[model samples]
Target: KVPTWTFHFQRSKRQRDDDALVLPQNQKNPKASRIAYKIEEYNPLLDSSNITPKDWAKIGKDIENNYMDYDGFVILHGTDTMAYTASALSFMCEHLRKPVIITGSQVPIYDVQNDGIENLLVALLIAGTYDIPEVGLYFHDKLYRGNRVTKVDAESFGAFSSPNLAPLVSTGVNITVNWNIVWRDKYQQRFQVSTEMNQNVGLLRLFPGITATTVRAFLQPPIEGVILETYGSGNAPDKDKALLDALKEATDSGVIIVNCTQCLRGTVSLTYATGAALKKAGVLPGADMTPEAALTKLSYVLAKKDLTLEEKKWVLFKNLRGEMTDAAGEPKLCLSDSRFIQAIAKSLSLSCTEELGAVRDALTPSLACAAAKTGDIEALEALKQLGSHLFFGDYDGRTPLHVACCEGNLNAVQYLLSQGATVHAKDRYGATPLSNAVHFRHKEVVELLRETGAHLSRDELDEAGVELCSLAASGDLEGLKLWILAGADLTKPGPDGQNVLQVAQSAGQKEVVATFSSCS
Candidate 1:
């Protein structure tokens, strides 16, 4: 299904050791013959660290020169500084419409147990077949956006991770591509290469007891940009007047200072007084961009000879090339609508369904229960359209509505009730959906059920109390709290004649026991 042309860059540690060229023909296990491709290895391979702005230009030129000839490009690179190269290339190749997969392995290809061959094979397949027209790193069975990846391991095959963004594709028995999250340009643009990256940018990480002299020296002249890796959420020492003055001096002189969080997961927020001080010092928030993306982007923006320093700073905050996420710009969801239909389809493994008949047959009782548990109206509608019985119950006599109430899926309970689902369906334990909702302490679900004239008789209330005691014994603190709020009788004995406190104590649920004691 795919053709391949392999280009080797002579910068990886494995390649430097002269181990990558030793093919399996000379090895004891020659079974590597099954892995086939139309290979074209280029000359003058350079190590990744030796790669610079000029090398990035050369790679971009090569891809642009051959853009019309090949469907995709596969680059074999060293793991060290691979993220840097990936980030740089992502900016250089503008309006890219063909896959540019960068991949490498911890072990050399010469080793029989090496991961190199598989990584190469998968990269080739992804580039050739998939329409992922962007720079990506395919390592260990996961394909990550080039700008979002970081190498976290040195000895294992699964060495790279993308903390902020999810993987573009995951390869296993079936290649699972998460189409929803894949970055796609709204309008097609002409492919062009921009290799002129200014090498004057630098990265400065703040440490404990870091002096102002050190910060000032790092942001000195000729460094047009500096990525200041600040404390959690981009906070630095506000009390350190010397450090603040140094940062102010850098910005006063027109040097762009971008504040990024030193921590891996969160974004930079200027809500804290200390963080707000940094903003006052002319340090722009880098949002949630990784250190790699921040540094490379700074270099790319600074190289724009046509733009002024202020213009470059303005462009840095913009989401160019999908490098940063604007957290405040996300839209709010309305629960009454079909906002969760796609998610329901994904959870039900129905994303690949092409026909309505297929959608109908796939809506098994288990699937219906799953959809109900999540309160997916779109999925339920699809099932109902396919002639699925809305009152369908599982082996335990628990219908879709019953499971929805137990899981506190208020939206699902409301939708099922509107769709004529029986309000008083009982499970094998003689527990109705209302009793289940009460036992679980699902306040929203209980309220919604009660509004629909769903009620529990005295016997049902007694059974629900027993279920609440069992939940207490299992250390379900939230469930116990909810049950109590719903007027569940804590004094009611469980099936074993133990009160809620006694059952919780016997099961070593100390927190539940404490909660029960507090309630009493």
Candidate 2:
């Protein structure tokens, strides 16, 4: 049997390690001041991997219970799933007019050289001092819009990165906040927290050889919503009619399937030819939102029993909190604008001149990425002439070529190709420009990259036994023979963790069963 947890309000309150619930110290709930807070610890501290929606709801309820008592809130969470949690809370907490910053350490706080102390301190300081009314994440002396942030590192102090947007605040000798971008609610709506979250949501990242049977199984029953992490922009394999048929059947039966991108940045427009098939199959475009944001938002949205399926889909696409960049509810800044670029250069004390070195320094990778996303060819050409390497990634490790491919900017892509950008260069998520192009369904860009011999490995699908299971499900005996001839493992479990033999048997493919027997 597994051990149960004992919840504590303070780290010091627990005399018995076996107790189920304990309260915090009286001193922790004193009158409000800078960095005023209370410890709400869970004994047998969970690695964030094990944190479930139920726990997320409980935290939301806790915040709701003490909403007005505190100026702002700080959640000391594990590194893993912190983004997921933050995104969930961004939805759960409606009309938030006070900061709710989540932060944690790469190294344990008890250890020397830990980021915990600084992270916690800054989180509290920002929570108390700032009037920026939204859920943000603090790490390594920088603050990001919560849902926009992703953990780009596993070992470094600089563990998180906001791929699409700049940091909300950067702390140095002085803390600078981008007030133009920080979300503000002027209507003075009351802050309310929602603990209601539908648990029947799923996240599926597509691969080259993922099967219809696997998709059907994963979305089998009791699943209300799914976040389909599609290829570049918002395309899936249009050739896979069976997979499309399965998804069509699901949405026809009132299941919400949101098309989210597997890439780090850009919107899921579902505008390409392949994306047409997905849209016809009842897929909704989840524009430029991270998978973490999509999944949690799906859950939070699905919980509303009052709303119809159509209304729910509408809500999903609508920019609820600044999560969707396409229909941004907040003010937007463009790097292509000379005044904005000048302002940024002025802040860095750099001259906005023809001096290539100064111009190169001013042309940050993030700014270049933004330009690439919007197909600003002028900026690309200028950066190219300034001797800036298109391959150089920002702090988040996103390259210009990848962003261009994601946005399907043919000119930018061609220019980068001519400039000799590495077609196989990977971002923090191991996604190459080719993969990003394919993910976004940039057919022209994909073709261009392919001409330069840019290709991604199909080993993940083969290793997961998708090919065998898919062939078995479809009774493609000849195909199975070829795969097995190339040393495919017939005894291997399928992508859903079921054996290939069992999958064939379940489908009543007698020929496939016999073939498996012969292979054995």
Candidate 3:
């Protein structure tokens, strides 16, 4: 039987003068203020792989119980499932205001040559000193956002890395914290541990010749959700009608199937025909989320008894808890992609310059979109000078203007607008520059797009953002969650001339503010 995990918050304060607080000169941080802490060694402590949601709840509860007393927390966990635990706690701790750093060393703490002590000391320092307000994983001197990390290696000291996002802090001679990416909650919500987790979620990794019976069996009874790991960018066998039918049937029966990529670093955009076919069969894109995050998120989301199946699906689409990146229709590429080889072969085979030019033209839209995303005007200018159409759409029908708005690149957006790029151009989702700006929380981009006469009709969005501020100001928690569930642009200013977050803060509606995370 799995041991029952519990917290023992035995308190003892120590000062710098006391010999009890002694540490090596190199291990200590001179800049950090004096901190007091207590240690608890759990009875029958298990390896990280043995940890469960119950243990996660206990950790979260322990943090919440001592939130006011301590500046931050450091969990000395095992490396095997450190990422999983970190991701779980990130979701479990609602409206956190302090650092919860999890770290472990590949070399055991008892070993003569060990990385454990150094990693532990740094994590403790960071937790006690920095104003990091999110769960983080500290490994090999780097502190990464908890949910974004994965175990990349077992033998190396650098056992973990956040593939899609950068580390929040790094430690050497002087600690460097990436304040720009740190999560700061605007609304001072009451902290709580959400212990409710439904473990009915399943994972189905697709391989060649995966049978229909296997897919159907995996989706059967009591399984509320499934993370369908597919080929590059969420593709599966499109021609296999029986296998497709199994997925279609599961989705049709209200089983939430999220399409995640097998690739370590990439968003699951349904751009290819294979991916589009899955979309048609009702598979939701699990954008840039690791399987561990997706699984835990499913357990957390599906456990919300108040949410309908559709509402759960909506939650999956959102970038909640810093678990995934909202690519916002940006052009994704790799230099080593096979398409470049195909282009070279086609160029060699074709004698016509115009046909070669057609291939060049076809590739330019993606490059232009990429430039717009990066706010690189020089690249955009070069592409334009080469007779590339700045207004052309990429694979998902997103133009350079849309990419600019999504990235909050004000200068790029202005340049595109000035150069006759379509201001009202819509992507495959019927989201224009204005819509992308509002959805992406780009306040300046939203204002500029509106000034350029881009309007959002009622049908364009799941919910009109106008009433969100009013609901927020009134401290209506359900109303706030409803709007969030309906997929309203929470970052957009309401008809009352204030955004929901700002309004919530002004009215001191902490709970209402807690319902939605900060846009960053």
Prediction-by-prediction clash tally: 3, 6, 0
Worst 10 residues of 2 by lDDT: 1-10
lDDT of all predictions, in order shown? 0.74, 0.73, 0.75
> Which residue ranges in model 3 land beyond 4 Å of their true spot?
1-32, 328-520
The residue ranges of model 2 lying beyond 4 angstroms of the native Cα positions read 1-34, 186-188, 328-520
lDDT score of model 1? 0.74
Number of the top candidate by TM-score?
Answer: 3
Least accurate 10 contiguous residues by lDDT in model 3: 1-10
- Candidate 3 TM-score, true structure as reference: 0.60
lDDT of 1 by residue, 177-294 (tens): 7653555433323467898998998999999899999999888878889999999999999999999999999999999999999988889998999999999999999998999999
* Alpha-carbon RMSD, each predicted model: 25.5, 28.6, 16.5
Instruction: Give me the overall lDDT of model 2.
Output: 0.73
What lDDT score is found at residue 43 in candidate 1? Answer: 56
Clashing pairs in 1: 10-45, 10-46, 11-47
The regions of model 1 sitting more than 4 angstroms off are 1-42, 328-520
